[model samples]
Target: MDLSELLDDLIRFWPVDVDDVSLIGHSMGGLVLRSAGHHGYEAAHEWTGKAKTYVSLGTPHSGAPLENLAHQASAILAARPETNAFGRLLRRRSGGIRDLRAGSLVDSDWQGRDPDGLAAAMAAEVPLLPGVDHYWVSATLTRDPKHPLSRVIGDGLVLHHSAGGRNSTRHIGFTEDNGLHLGRANHFNLLNDARIAAKLVDWVG
Candidate 1:
C-alpha cells in the first residue's frame, strides 16, 4: 500500500496503539501525508489520537510541474537501472492507471480547483485536522533583485504555490539573511542540507 493509504489506516485505528501521532514528510512525502488528511480528516478527529505537526520542505503539495515536463520515462531511461523506481512508476501511471495524463499537468489554472484538484484539495482540506500545526519550509539563493519574484532565488524545483499553506507555523526564508544556502540539494534533497537538518532537529524536538 502507498504511504497515503497507511496514513489513512493509522488515523482510523490510531487509538488502538498510540496516543497521538505527528506525521513528518518531506517533498512528495508531504503531499502523501496531506492526501492522507484530505481523504481521512473526518475519521481522524474522533480518535484519542491527534496529528500534531506537519512539516514540508519544498514539498510540491500541488504536484511537481517539472515531472510533467520531463516525462518520467525519459528521465528514468536516462538514469541508471538501479534507482529508477520513480521512472518505472511514472510509466505505469502514464500508461493507463491515470484518468487523463495530459490534462493533469500543473498550470496556474490548477490553483482554481475546488474539491477535486490537487492544489485546491490540499489548501482547503489538509489544515482542517484538529490540533495540527503546519510548517512550510522553502529554499532559495540570492535574490536577483531585478524581477520581483525572481528575487527569491528558489531551488528551482518548488515554485511558490507548492510551498504555501494557510496554517503554516514557519515560513522559513533561507538564504544569506539567516544562513547560507547549500550549493547542492535540489527539491528532492530532503535529507541533504545541513541547515535544513538543523531546522528539522529544532522543529520536531
Candidate 2:
C-alpha cells in the first residue's frame, strides 16, 4: 500500500498522538520513514516526548539483493525515471544511498540517478538524535543446511552483516536459547515476536 495511505489509516485507527506513539517499523516501513522525511521521528516528536526509537528488521542498511530484480524490471519497463515501484521505493525514502549501485545488490549498475530514500538515509543516519536509538536485526535465509550462512550467522533472509545501524549495530538472535539455531524468523518476528514484546514496551517506556 502507498505510504501516505498507510499513515492516513494509522492516524484514524491508532488512538495515540505523536507524543504517545512508539514508532516501530520493519523493512519498507523504515524506508518509508526516510522517504517521508522520517515521519516516524516527526510523529514521535509531536506525540511522544522524544524522537521515537527505530528498529529495522531486515531493512538493508547497505542495500538489498532485491534491487537487482528491480533494476532488471526497470530496464524491462523502458528505463523510466523512478517510475517503477522498486526503484522509486528506495529513492523516495532518504538521501545519500550508496547501497543501490550497480553490483551492490539490487540495481547492480554503476549508473547514477536522483537521490533515494536508501541514499538519503545513509548520509543522514549518523549522530542519531537523543532518545532515538535504532537497532538492526539481520536474517540469513537459505535452504542449504551446510550453507555458510546457515553454518555461521544470519536470521535467514538477512545476512549478519546486514543487521544494525549504518555505522554501528547490535546483532541479536531472535531466539534467546541459541545464537546458531540456523533457522530464520519472519521479518516481523525480529521486532514483534512473542518473546520480545515486553522488551519493546520497556524500550518505549
Candidate 3:
C-alpha cells in the first residue's frame, strides 16, 4: 500500500510528463511491484501503463521452497513451550514474507487466510500489462542448473525455474529470450552483477 501510494505521488508530482518508465526489481521487491501493477490506487493504471519494461532480478516468482521449510520448522518450534517465543517471532513474519509462499501478487491471494498456515490458493490470476515487456534474471550458485545441489539450493533460497518464471503449472507469459541465468551467482549478487546491469540497460533501452 505504501509503495502504491508513493508511486501514485511520484506520477502526480513529477515535473515531466512521463509517458514511459522501466521498472527494475530485486528479490521481494519484484513481487511488491507486481502487486502494485496488479491492484494499486486509482491512478495506478496511468503510471503502470507507462512501464515499457519490467525486469525481475532473482525474484521467486513461483514461491520459495525454503520459506515453506521455515514455516514448517517454525510450527514445530512453536509446539514446544521452551522455544515458543522464537517460534512466535518467526511465525509473525511481515505480509511480504507470508506472500512469498506462493508469490502472491494481489490482496485476494492471501486475504482472510491464516498467514502461518499453508499457502492459500490464488483465487484469480494477475496478468501483466498488455503492452509491457517482462524480463527475468535468475542466479545459480552452481555451474549447472541440472546439478542436484543447484536444484535444492538455488542461489541459496530460490529455485532457478521459479526465479526464471518457468514453472509448468503457472504461465506468466515471459518469453525465452527475456530470461537470463547467471552461473555461480547468489541471490544478492544478482542485484550487483555487471552483466545483469548491462542486460537491464540493453533490454530497457
Ranking the candidates on lDDT from highest down gives: 3, 1, 2
Q: How does each model score on TM-score? A: 0.52, 0.48, 0.90
What's the CA error at residue 98 for candidate 1, in Å? 7.8
lDDT of 1 by residue, 40-82 (tens): 5544433214567667676654444455444545455537677
Q: What is the TM-score (0 to 1) of candidate 3? A: 0.90
Each candidate's number of clashing pairs is 0, 31, 0
lDDT winner, 1 or 3: 3
Off by over 4 Å in 1: 1-17, 45-48, 68-128, 141-153, 166-185
Specify the poorest-scoring 10-residue window by lDDT in model 1.
Answer: 96-105
Report the Cα lDDT for residue 117, model 2: 20
**After superposing candidate 3, which stretches have Cα over 4 Å from the reference?**
41-44, 119-124
Q: Compose the digit string of candidate 3's lDDT tens values, residues 44-155.
A: 4567767688889988888888777878878888889999998898887877787777788777766677667655435346677567899998888998877899998899
